[model samples]
Each structure stands twice: as structure tokens, then as C-alpha cells.
Target: MLEIKAVTKKFGNDIAVDHLNMVLEPGRVMGLIGQNGAGKTTTFRMILDFIQPTSGSILWNNQPIDLKAKQRIGFLPEERGLYQKITVEEQILYFAELHGMRRSDARQALMEWMKRLDVVGKVTDKVQKLSKGNAQKVQLIASVIFQPEFVILDEPFSGLDPVNMSIMMSEIQRLRDQGAMIIFSSHDMNNVSHISDDLTMLKKGKTVLQGGLKEIRERYGRTKLYIESPLTMSQLRSIPGVTQVTAQENGLLVELADENVGKVIFEKATANGYIPAFSQQPPTLDDIFRMEVAADV
Candidate 1:
């Protein structure tokens, strides 16, 4: 397990990360989310020992993370790093050697990874020759070439299309299933909701929310509702406890001040007997994310 206890980072007078606490167990994936400059990167850097926290401790198991432990962690930073002139084989083998893998083993691993990820070109191709998506895949392959026990990925899904995103998600899940502790940061709430077993939300460098995704969403109650019926817009707006009603292509999205309001809407919509759809559920991660940001502002 990886534990971050009351970790705080300061630069002169500014607090980049403020007393953040988190735990990542093997086989679990943690999602770190916040707007830009909210300190997501700072937290990752502290874990990688790229920088030191002003106060607090970061540990793996029962001891502080030292050089040996650091070597077992794989990191993919938000900023992409690859030499345009280097061949794909050379680049990956270099990183693999840096992490203490034998060059021959690294060579075999690179071949397997490239094929598994469906890179369009061969290892002999220069890094600059690959498309953006392929280059990103190669970068991801580099991060995990040695199959580290812990992984940190920053914006792993950025710029990926739906299909490529699915591919990336599959790979992340595979790593988790293999008992590698994983933590990643992404602005895409859909991806986070799909993969995260634990979540931490930050606002201005302070943790505003942290817990299991379901546990946190349940606390907000299932106030988001959707329905397809003959009910007019004004009719929904007039109902008590009805906070907002917006029309979508297929139906109306209703936000109730209380989940109980859903029963009332249901009774009214189904009075004549049949309705196409009625769904009352917890606010999605996207909704919660916006609410948190707005609440702080």
C-alpha cells in the first residue's frame, strides 16, 4: 500500500498542496481530480520525490519510500517527453535500462507491448514518425515497460478518441487486476467514474471531497431524474421540490431538491398509466464536480 499522510507543499508563501491524505492499496485505482493549478501535478511530484513536501510523510508499506521503492514506481507526466530523433526501440530500451531492466528483456517486452497496443509502425521507426495517438501509446508503453508495482498516470486519456480511450482504459484495468497500485488525474469525469475505486477532489489545493465514489455520491442523494412523458416543461417546473427542468432531445432532465420529489413526478406522469421512461439516480460525478467547483467560488 502507498500512504500519503498530511502531505503539504509550500513555495515561499503559496501552498501548492495543503495537508492532503490518501491511501492506494494494491489492485485499486485512485482518481485525483481538480481544475488546472489545483495542485494535482504537485501531489504527483511529491510522490515521485521530484520535489519534497514541506511537512508530512509518504510511505510504501510501513517504511518511507526510498530509492529502491522509487524504482518500482512508474510515472507518466502530463507533459509528453520523447526525443523526435530517437528510434522507438532505442527510446524504450533506454528508459527500461534506467529502471534496471536487462536490455534483452526490455527488447522482448517492447515488442510485446507494441503489438498488444496496436501501434501502426515497427520499432525501427523514429518517434517523430508516429501520429499523436500512437506516440501517446508509445509513451504509455514506456511508463510500464518493466511492469512496475505502482503507477502514476497524468492525463492518460487526453486527446484520445472514444475507441482509443477504451483501449487505454482496458490497459489501466489490466494493470490494476495484476495488483499494481494505480493513481491517475484526469478532467474527464466519465473516465474517472468508469475506473476509480477511490476518489479525491481538490479545490485550490485543498481536498474538498475524498472517499469511495458510490459512498460520496450516495451522500448527495439520488436527486437527478430523467423522464419521457407527455408532461410539459411548465408542469415540471410548477411541482414542489422541483429545482430545475431542462429539455433534452429524448426527454426532460429534472433536478429535484429532494429525491422524494421523484415519486411525485412519477405519480403525475404515470397517472394515465404508461410512460416511456423514468430514471431517478444519484448525481453523476460530472454533476458533483461542477457543484463542488461552484460551491467554492
Candidate 2:
């Protein structure tokens, strides 16, 4: 288990991270999300001991994490960290060796990881020769080459297409199933929603929301209605208790001031005689994100 107990980081008079507390156990995935300057990277740095925290403590298994424990952690920063001139196999082996693996074992692990991660091209090919997506895959392979017990991935899906995203997600799940504690940051709310067991949302270095995704949504309540029909946005907004209506592909996402207003919209939809679909559910993560961070804009 990893515990971040009231951890805070400061630069002179400016505070980058403010009293953030979190507990992550093995086999759990925690998603850290916020705007660009929300201190996600700073928190990761503190966890990795790249920079010391100005206050509080970071512990692994109830003890302060040290050099020996650092070997078990894997980090994939938001920026690409690779030698463009090196071959993909060499890069993976280099990272594995840094974690104390023997050359022969590292080479064997590289071959197996390449096959499992579905990395393209030959092992001898230079990192500079691969496409953007393939290069990202190689970087991901390096992060997990030694099978670290704790993994931190920042924007791991940056250059991935839908199919590649699916592949990366599968690999991350595999790591979690092996009892690794994973913490990742992503601007992609949909991907975060699908992957994270729980979420810790930050804004201006402060934790704005933190909890299991389902519980958070349930607590936020069912205030949004999804309707796929001929009814236009204007018509939906004109209904009593309906406060906002946003048009979406094949539907209008209608926001209600009162939950009971959903029934009114349902009746109106029935009268129009073209009800393809109707669902009243809690707001999505995307919706909650915008709502929580709207003041920052």
C-alpha cells in the first residue's frame, strides 16, 4: 500500500500541491485529473522523490519509501523520455537493468514484453524510425519492463487511436491484476471513467473531489436526461423545470432543475410519437469535470 499523508509542495511562496491525502492499495487504479497547472505532475514527482515535499510524508507499506523501495516503482511521465538514437530493445533492456535486472534476463523480458504489448517493427529498429503511436508504445514498454509493483503513468494515451487505446488499457489492466498499485493522470475523461477504480480531482492544487466513481455519480444525483428523438433543443429547454439542453449526436442531453422534470419530458416525448430512447441518469464524469472546474475558466 502507498499512503500520501497531507503531502504539500511549495516553490518559494507559491504552493503547488496543498495538503493532499490519498491511500492506494495494490490492485487499485487511481486517476488524478485536473487542468494543466493542477499539480498532477508535482504530486508524481513527490511520490518518486524527484523533489522532496515541503511538508507531510509519503510512505510505502507504513514505512518511508527509500532507494530500495524506489526500485519497485515505474513512472511514465507526460513528456516522452527516450533516447531517439537507441533501438527499442536496447531502451527496454537499459531501463530493466537500471532496476537491477541482469542483462540476459532483461533481454528475455524485452522480447516477451514486445510480443505482449504488440509493439510493431523489429527490435533492432531505432526509436526515431517508429511512428508517433509506436514510439509511445515503446515508451510504455520501458515503464513496465521490470514489472514494478507501483506504476505512475501520465497521459499514457496521448498519441493513441481508439484501437491503440484499447490495447494500452488491456495492458494496464494486466499490471493491476498482478497486484501493482497504479496511479495515472489523463485529460481524457472518457478513458479515465472507464479505467479508474476511484478518482481524485484537483483544482488549483487542492482536492476538489475524491471517491469511487460510482459513489460520486450517485451522490451527485440524477439530474440529466438523455433523449434520442425528433424533439429539438429549444423544445426541451422550454419545458418546465428544464434548465439547460445541449445537443449531442443522435440525442439531446437535457438538464433538469428537478428530477421529477424528467417525467414531464418523457410525457412530451411520448406525445411527439418518436421516442427512440429516453434515459434519466446522473451526470457523466465529463459533465462533473466541467461543472467542478468551471470557476477556473
User: Which numbered prediction scores highest in TM-score against the true structure?
Assistant: 1
Query: Per-residue lDDT of 150-207 in model 1, one digit per residue for the tens?
Result: 9999988888878789988999999999999999999999999999999999888899
Q: Each model's C-alpha lDDT?
A: 0.93, 0.89
lDDT of 2 by residue, 31-143 (tens): 99998999999999999889999999999999888888888898898888789999988888888888877889989888887787677888899999998778888888888
Each prediction's TM-score against the native?
0.97, 0.91
lDDT of 1 at 71: 79
Best-performing candidate as measured by lDDT: 1
Q: TM-score of predicted model 1? A: 0.97
Question: 17 in model 2: Cα distance from truth in Å?
Answer: 0.4
Q: Give stretches of model 2 more than 4 Å off.
A: 228-235, 246-251, 267-275
lDDT at 92, model 1: 96
